[model samples]
Target: MSLLKEKILQVASDLFQTRGINSTGVDTIVAVAGTTKMTLYKHFHSKEGLIIEVLNEHYRHFHAWLSERLDRKKPAERLQKLFDFIEEWVSSPDFHGMAFLKASAEFPDASSPIHELSNTHSQQFRRYLAELAADAGIADAEGLALQLSLLIEGAMQAEQIKRGSGAIVYAKKAANILIKSSLR
Candidate 1:
């Protein structure tokens, strides 16, 4: 990405996460990004295109982080690391729920690129969980992975809703138990 494009994505991500996707106009993003409408449109075809790029950037960062943490570890340990990652996210200073979750909630239709990206991210998470479960030799890796994914995703929302008081604590405990039991 060019410097200008990177700057725009960063500004757009911050604005979309804070003010929301629908409400944050392109002009606001360009202004905050220290650019002009011509530059913005030159880099991204439209506001919707910009939104897609923002989501893609976020997902790329998050996926890289998760992959780095869980790479080539024992299945159980990798699973634990995933939980730890979630805890870190919960404790992040700007943890206003998940950006994708918030975006999907704001735009429920599957026709949009935002919704498609959200579903793609969800699929990636499921695949990661399934791989870990299989490496652990779980009887039904697919099923277990789905359950574990749901638990982690649910706990994230729960933490955000409850303001992260004890949500991570409960989620970690529940996740560990689920992983252990699934391996048995």
Candidate 2:
């Protein structure tokens, strides 16, 4: 990416997360990004196009962070590491709930590209979990993946409401039970 494009994305991403996607305008992005509207248009074409790139870029960073938290140890340990990292993430001060969930809430149109990208990001994560479960010799890796996905989502929501108090404890315990049962 060009220097100008990267700057625009960074500014827009911070503004979007802090304010909101729908609330943040192209003009504001350009102002914070220290670029002209023409430059942004030349690179992203439109606000929607910029939003798509911002989301796609967020996914790349999120995936890299999640990957770093996992190891190639026993399959169950790999998942447990993921669960622990999630708890850490939720507890972090920077976490403002799931970014995709926030984006989806802002763009409720199911047919929209933003919504589709949000869902795709989630499905990809679930598939990654399923891969872990399958490697652990679980009989129904898909089922386990869904179960874990729900737990993670629920925990995020709970953290939003409860401000990160005790949600992870229950989530971690439930994950252990779910993973244990799947191995049997």
Candidate 3:
């Protein structure tokens, strides 16, 4: 990516994550990025285009972070590691729920690109969980993955609503029960 484009994306991602998609305008993005609207348009074509790129960037960063944390763990431990990471994440001061979930809420129209991208991001994460479950020798990996995915989503919402309470701790306990039951 071009240096200017990268800067724009970083600035936009920070603003969008902190503020929101609809609340942060192009003018603010340009101003913070130290680039003009014309330059942003030249690089991204439009604000929606920029938003899509920002979403993509967010997914990339999220996936990289998750992978780095879980890759070294054994297949059976991966799920636990995932929940551990989430627990720490929700406890952190910077926690603000899932960015994709926030984006989906902002763009409720199912046909919208932002909405579709957010859905794709979620499905991809679920697929990853399913793969891990299968590798761990679970018989119903798909079902287990779906259940775990629900727990993760529920924890995110609960944390958001409760402002980073013990939702993840409970979620992790539920996940452990699910994993034990599934293995049996």
Q: How close is every model to the real structure, measured as TM-score? A: 0.92, 0.91, 0.93
Report the lDDT tens digits of candidate 3 across residue range 64-114: 887888888987788768899878767777777788989999999999999
Tens digits of lDDT, candidate 2, 1-184 = 7999999999998888778898998989899888899999999878999999998888788778877767546665787677788887778876767778788888889999999988998899899889988877888999999999999988887887668467888888999999888787
Poorest 10 consecutive residues by lDDT, candidate 3: 88-97
lDDT of each: 0.81, 0.85, 0.88
Native-referenced Cα lDDT, model 2: 0.85
Please say which candidate is ahead in lDDT: 2 or 3.
Answer: 3
Q: Report clashes for each candidate as comma-separated counts.
A: 0, 0, 0
In the order shown, the candidates' Cα RMSDs to the true structure are 1.6, 1.7, 1.4
Task: Rate residue 29 of model 2 by lDDT.
Answer: 88
Pairs of residues clashing in candidate 1: none
120-174, model 1: which lDDT tens digit per residue? 8888878878887887777888898898878877877786677747777777898
Predicted model with the maximum lDDT: 3
